[model samples]
Target: MLELRGLGKRYTVHDREVVALADVDLVLKPGSFTVVVGRSGCGKSTLLRLLAGLTLPTTGAIHHNGGRPKVGCVFQEPRLMPWLTVAGNVGFGLVGKVTKAEIEARVEAALALVGLSDFRNAYPDQLSGGMASRVGLARALVLEPELLLLDEPFAALDAFTRRGLQGELTDIWLARRPTVVFVTHDVEEAVLLADEVLHMDGGRIIGRREVPLPRPRDATDREFVALRRAILDDLSGRAGSSPPPA
Candidate 1:
């Protein structure tokens, strides 16, 4: 399990202290999928960055049952090395840490997982936006991390590509149950993918809603519609501290 206790961060900008996160206490069980959703500047990215150890919290602790676990992260953009081929980009994280043959095998598998096997030799410039984003996801998955952190990785994709990748992501999670923490502003995406959806505002997690919906869910399903509506209302200032039960 991974736990955050009183986790907070204060950044100094131009000699003033700005709190990015405040008193965030969370418990994430192994192999669970959770989504953090809120408007921009709500500190969702800050919280994920803290979890990924990209930054340190100013006033709290992060604890895990075992030693530091392997982590993988994907950001809003692909961030691929422009000159590297698809296979090389996927295997970038394993450089010098593993053998050439090992890297080749993992990259091959990851490319296949994300349906990019045929484009192994293509450089970043050759791929479309959606394909490049999948390459980013494959790069992270190649590490086979215990913790996967995604910061709105698909926010830039078109609606069709976004929906397709969402299903693919669900399939990947079911096949390899890593602890996933995804941050996004899309309420529909949150309800569609999260086991638990956390709402944030002004650097704090103010509400949470359990999805408890089955995989390959239907957006038009009554329950799914209701859950999405409740979350939208909550985020739009029409609901209470927590969204009423779905």
Candidate 2:
């Protein structure tokens, strides 16, 4: 489990203090998939960065409940190395510390998990947008991380590709059961992917909505629509009513 208490981050822009996150208190369970949704600059990405240890908080602390856990992070872009092939990028993290056999095995397993086995030798420039994003996912999964943080990884793709990748991501999460915090601004995407959806605004968490719906959710379903409506309402500052609890 991971816990955040009074977590805050602030940065100075031209000597002017700008607050990014403010007093966030959250608890993330092992194998739980939580998605944070908010407008850009609402501090969604900042929270993920704090969790991934890419940045230090100006206040409060992140508790791992014990020792530090292995963390993997994928940003909005694929960010693959231009010179590395699919397999090479996937195994980048394991290159020096692990042996050849171990790296190959882990890399192969990750590619299989992401359904990119056929593209092992393909370079980044050769991959389509959707395929490149999958390679990014494979790179993260290769570490077999205890915690995975993804920030709008599929936001750029077309609708068809986005939905397909969303399904694949859900499958990966279900199979590996990694503690995941995926950040996105898309309400429907959040509804489709998360076990629990968190709403953030102005650098603070506003509400929490749990999606108890079963796998392979249908957006056209009444329940799913209601859930999305509740999130939209909350985001708009009119949370007087919400979808009935699942």
Candidate 1 matches the true fold with a TM-score of 0.97
Question: Lowest summed lDDT over 10 consecutive residues: which window, candidate 2?
Answer: 237-246
Clashing pairs in 1: none
Q: Largest lDDT belongs to which candidate?
A: 1
Q: Which tens-of-lDDT digit does each residue in 170-199 have in candidate 1? A: 999999999999999999999999999999
- TM-score per model over all chains: 0.97, 0.96
> Could you give candidate 2's per-residue lDDT for residues 45-75 as a string of tens digits?
9999998898999999999966788998887
Off by over 4 Å in 2: 243-246
- How close to the true structure is residue 171 of candidate 1, measured as C-alpha lDDT? 95
Give the lDDT of residue 136 in candidate 2: 92
Global lDDT of each candidate: 0.93, 0.92
